[model samples]
Target: MTTQTYLVSGMSCGHCETAVRSELGAVPGVQQVEVSAATGRLTVTTDGSVDDATVIAAVDEAGYQAQRG
Candidate 1:
């Protein structure tokens, strides 16, 4: 498994966390997703290699921004 952490922006509530989690969870190879709106942090666990672009795009789809940390 691979674990990655990202710094996300514009997350201010539980709903934001949910959106980020749902989007990241949809990514191929993603096994788990953890997000904290308070901290604006996102962590993803995957069964295989997952690219930063994919994760960033997922966050964008969730109506937020993210960058690998």
Candidate 2:
């Protein structure tokens, strides 16, 4: 398994966290997702290697911006 942490922007509430989490969780190979709006942190656990671009796209689809941390 692989765990990656990302810094996300424009997350200010629980709804933001949920949106980010839902999107990240949908990525292929993602096993788990944890997002914190208060801290602007997103943690993703995957079964194997997952591309950074894939995660960034997921965050974009969720209406936020993110980068690998």
Candidate 3:
């Protein structure tokens, strides 16, 4: 497994957090996600094949921006 952290912007509430989480969760390799809007961070655990672009795209679809840490 691989663990990655990302900084996300534009998340402001619980609904936003859930949206982002759900989006990421739908990805095939994603196993866990922790989002902290107050700190603008997201931590993800997934299988090694998943790349940062895939995670970022998921965040974008959920209405936010993300970059790998």
Candidate 4:
């Protein structure tokens, strides 16, 4: 498995985490999504290499911004 962590902004609660997770979880090859609003971090585990742009796009769709850290 491959894991990537991104720094996400504008997340302040569980709802925010859920939104991010839901969006990221939909991405192909993603096996798991773990997000923390308090830490402003989003971690994704995938079976293979997942494009950074795609990950960021998913975060954007969740109403937040993210960049690999």
Q: What does candidate 3's lDDT look like per residue over 1-69, in tens digits? A: 999999999999889899999999999999999998888899999987789999999999999999986
Clashing residue pairs in candidate 1 are none
| Candidate 4 lDDT tens digits, 1-69 | 999999999999999999999998889899999899999988899987788999999999999999999
lDDT by residue (tens digit), candidate 1, 38-60: 89889999986888899999999
Best by TM-score: 3
Clash counts for the predictions, in order: 0, 0, 0, 0
Candidate 2 Cα errors over 4 Å, as ranges: none
lDDT of 3 at 12: 93
Query: Which stretches in model 4 have alpha-carbon errors above 4 Å?
Result: none
Number of clashes found in candidate 4: 0
Please state the error at residue 18 of candidate 2 in Å: 0.5
Candidate number of the best lDDT: 3
Candidates in order have lDDT scores of 0.92, 0.91, 0.94, 0.93
Q: Would you estimate the TM-scores of all the predictions?
A: 0.95, 0.94, 0.96, 0.95
Error of 2 at 1 (Å): 0.3
User: How displaced is residue 29 in candidate 1, in Å?
Assistant: 0.4
| Regions of model 1 farther than 4 Å from truth | none
For model 3, the local distance difference test gives: 0.94
